[model samples]
Target chain A: EAGVAQSPRYKIIEKRQSVAFWCNPISGHATLYWYQQILGQGPKLLIQFQNNGVVDDSQLPKDRFSAERLKGVDSTLKIQPAKLEDSAVYLCASSSGLVFSYEQYFGPGTRLTVT
Target chain B: AQTVTQSQPEMSVQEAETVTLSCTYDTSESDYYLFWYKQPPSRQMILVIRQEAYKQQNATENRFSVNFQKAAKSFSLKISDSQLGDAAMYFCIWGANTPLVFGKGTRLSVIA
Candidate 1:
């Protein structure tokens, strides 16, 4: 089976610019997540989606950051008017479903460098 | 709210030796999951091992094993017969749903 797929492994943008990252999760997977990993820190959950609906996004910066899992197969994370503090690796992960305890499959994250 | 902690900022081990990474967590839920994820230079978070809180027997995968102490709220990873490829940042995580809480990872270096 194919692993989670992400586009534009590295991105560079100026502060206040808008940037978007895409993720295509493993086929048949029902849950998808987006996380941010700053240097010397662990990945922080940004948002989570179960199928086409969001499960949790309490930690997300709703003022600037937004994500959507359209059609429940692929998802996208966007940061409008990005800040310098947002310069970190954005990771995408997916799991099988709610009942099973399948391990999360992660993709090669998109490293966003805001100058 | 659940939180994971990894006090070790960095650790090193010799090839063929064993090294243990310590992790402690805080949670109120009786049923949850613990995980060890490895992130190498490629930047992909790979699942190394996982354990259910209710399970008594430790979970082991290949040369990797977990020492899960539910009472103490501690979970640690022990790597036996360490290899050069094992050198990476290992993150301990806990959660029940899509959002997982991770500890500050421990960077492990293996000497050849």
Candidate 2:
């Protein structure tokens, strides 16, 4: 019954720094997702994981953005050498990963600021 | 690739009034899912409603309902008897054969 949980509700770092965020999906959830939301924009999927394996990462900035969902329940998203453009909210979500339509439960996103 | 568009960047409505938010998306898949999410200042994304492409009848939840025009690629959210709590940024999203994609979003303001 618990919702998706995220750590480090807020973070501030300078350009060229590195930042990491953690997420704990709901119990028994098989799919995890990380998204980035810039001001005045909608959230964009950075990566998706199905039980510890990546389902999609085509939109991810592979050079700088990396995410892993180890053990299939918890996920971590990292941004190395964070750029000013990377200043946004990092959102974690999870779903049933079933064939039918399932809603994703979102966490109180981590707000990251890169100066 | 799938793309979502929310042409109205902002809208305002008085309390107890009704408002509609427009959304459109492009997709090649015949069966997929469309959703509307609301994000308030607290920064948590909340699901408002969803529509399935395979279903012809529209979906409704309490005071929230959707007008799904599959051929026109239009999905709109209509909130009846809007309240101040309805003030937030609404995002239109779709996931076809690919991953989910969200639109720029429309900010709604409720004037008491």
Candidate 3:
């Protein structure tokens, strides 16, 4: 089985610019997640989707960050008018069942740098 | 709200030796799960071990084992026969009905 795949392993953008990251989860996985990991810190959940529908995004900064999983297989996370504080690694993960009950496979994260 | 804490920022162990990484969590849920994830410099997070709250026996996988103390709300990982491949950032996580919460992570280094 293939693992979760993410695009553009590294990205650099200027402040106030817009950037987007893509994620293609493992086939047959029902749950997908996006997390942000700042340097020296663990990944923090940004959004979670169960199939095509969203399960939780309370921590997401709706004002500038948005994500969507249109077909339930692939997802994209976007940040518009990015801030310097947004420079961090964005990780995508998928699980066949609820995270607490099943193992989640993570993809090689996209490291974003805002100038 | 659930929170995971890794007090140690970094630790080093000699090859073929043993080392323990400490973690403590705060959660009100009676039943939940705890996990240790390893992220090498490659940036992919891998599951090292997992422990269920209701289980009495601590979870162990090969040379990796977890000492889960429910009463103290502590979960620590013990790596035996440490190898250079074990060098990475180790994160402690708390999982319940809600989303998983992660610790700051401990960077482990193995000396040859």
Candidate 4:
């Protein structure tokens, strides 16, 4: 079975510039998630989508970051006026069932470097 | 709120040897789950093992096993017969019905 897929394995943008990352979840998976992983830290959930509907996005910085899962299959995360602190890897994951019952499969994250 | 902690920032093990990485978590919910995920330099997060809070039997998969102490809220991963490919950043995660909370992560290095 194919795993989660992401685009532009690496990206670099100037501070204050805008950047976007794309994710395509595994076929048939109902839950999708976007996470940000800073250097030397674990990945933190930026947002979660349950079939195109947001499940949780409390940790997301609304002022600069936004994400959407259109049609419940492909998702996109965008950051406007990116800050140097926003330089990190953005990971996309998908699970078939509730997290407690099913394991999540992650994609090779897109590394965003804001200069 | 649930939190996961990995005190050991880094650890090294000789190839073919064994190593154990420690993790502790706090959660008020009784129906939660614990997980160990491995992230290699290639940047892919892979699920290593998972343990349910109510299960008494420790979860094991091949050379990977978890020592889970529900009462202590401690979950540690033990990798036996370690191989070079086992070197990666390991994260401990806590999850209930909500989004997962991840620890800072422990970097494991296998020396040949």
Candidate 5:
């Protein structure tokens, strides 16, 4: 089965510029997530959506980060007026949501660099 | 909030040898899932193995296995007969009703 898919495998932008990342989840998966991985740390969830509705986004930076899942299948994460500190690997993951364990399938992340 | 911790930042092993990475977590929930994910240089996080808190027997997947101690909130991954392909960043994660919380990750290197 095809795993979660993300676009723009790499991105470079200047501070205050706007950048967006897109994700296409595996068919039939009900849960989608966006995470940010700093150079030396594990990925942290930026937002989560269950089907078309958002489930959690407490960790998201409301001032600069935003994400949406349209039709519950494809999702997009955006960072407007980016800062140098925002440079990191943006990862997209999806899960079947059928069982408790909910094994997640990850996409090849989009590495973003804000200079 | 739940948190995962990987104490070892880096580990190295000779080819065909064994290496173990340590992880510990803090959580109030009794039953949840724990996972070990491998991220190669290519940067795709892949599931290496997983353990359910309710299961007493350790979860094993081929040469990769987990030692899960629920009472102590400790989980560790052991790679047996390690190969160069096993070199990657290993992350310990705690899964529950909320999004999975990940540790900083342990980078493993295999020397041939």
Candidate 6:
């Protein structure tokens, strides 16, 4: 089976510029997630969607970060007027959503460098 | 909010040796999941192993195994007969009704 796919494996942008990352989940997967992984840290969930409907996004920064899972299959995460601290790997992951299951297939991630 | 902690920032072990990475979490929920994920230099997140809260027996996958102590909220990963390819950043995660809360990760180095 094909794993989760993400576009722009690497991105470099200046602070205050805008950048967006895209993700295509595995076929038939119902849950999608966006995570931010700073250096030396694990991926932190920025948002989660259960078939285009947000399941959780409390950790998302509303002022500069936004994400949407249109049609419940492909998702996009955007950061406008980025900051230096925003430089990190933006990882997208998907899962089957079965009960008692925590297996999530993750993409290679888009490495964002904000200068 | 639930939190995961990996006390060891980095660990090193010679090839064919064994090493354990420590993790501790704080949560109030009774039902949850614990996961150990490996991210190599390629940056792909790979599932090493997972343990369910209700399961008494530790989850093992080949050379990877987890020691899950629910009462103490401690979960650790042991890599047996380690290989140089096992070098990666190992993340301990706590899965709840919401998203998975990750620890600061432990970077493991395998010297050949």
Best by DockQ: 3
List the pairs of residues colliding in candidate 6: none
Inter-residue clash pairs, candidate 4: none
Report the C-alpha lDDT of model 6 over B65-91, residue by residue, as the tens digit.
989999999999999999989999999
Instruction: Mark the regions of model 1 whose C-alpha exceeds 4 Å error after superposition.
Output: none
Model 3, residue A99: C-alpha shift (Å): 4.4
Candidate closer to the true structure by DockQ (higher is better), 1 or 4: 4
Clashing pairs in 1: none
Instruction: Specify the poorest-scoring 10-residue window by lDDT in model 6 chain B.
Output: B93-102
Model 5 lDDT on a 0 to 1 scale: 0.92
Q: Write the per-residue lDDT of candidate 2 for residues B1-112, one digit (tens) a residue.
A: 6789999999999999999999999988899999999988796788999888999999999999999999999999999999999999999999764467889999999999
DockQ of each: 0.67, 0.65, 0.76, 0.75, 0.72, 0.67
lDDT of 3 by residue, B8-103 (tens): 999999999999999999988899989999998886899999999999999999999999999999999999999999999999999886478899
Best by TM-score: 3
iRMS (Å) per candidate = 2.2, 2.1, 1.4, 1.6, 1.7, 1.9
lDDT (Cα, tens digit) per residue for candidate 5, span B3-105: 8999999999999999999999999999899999999988689999989899999999999998898999999999999999999999999987666889999
Clash counts for the predictions, in order: 0, 0, 0, 0, 0, 0
Better of 2 and 5 by TM-score: 5
Q: CA lDDT, every prediction?
A: 0.92, 0.90, 0.94, 0.92, 0.92, 0.91
lDDT of 1 by residue, A17-80 (tens): 9999999999999989899999989998898888999888999999999999989999999999
In terms of lDDT, model 4 sits at 0.92
Q: Show pairs that collide, candidate 3.
A: none
Question: Weakest 10 consecutive residues, lDDT, candidate 2 chain A?
Answer: A95-104
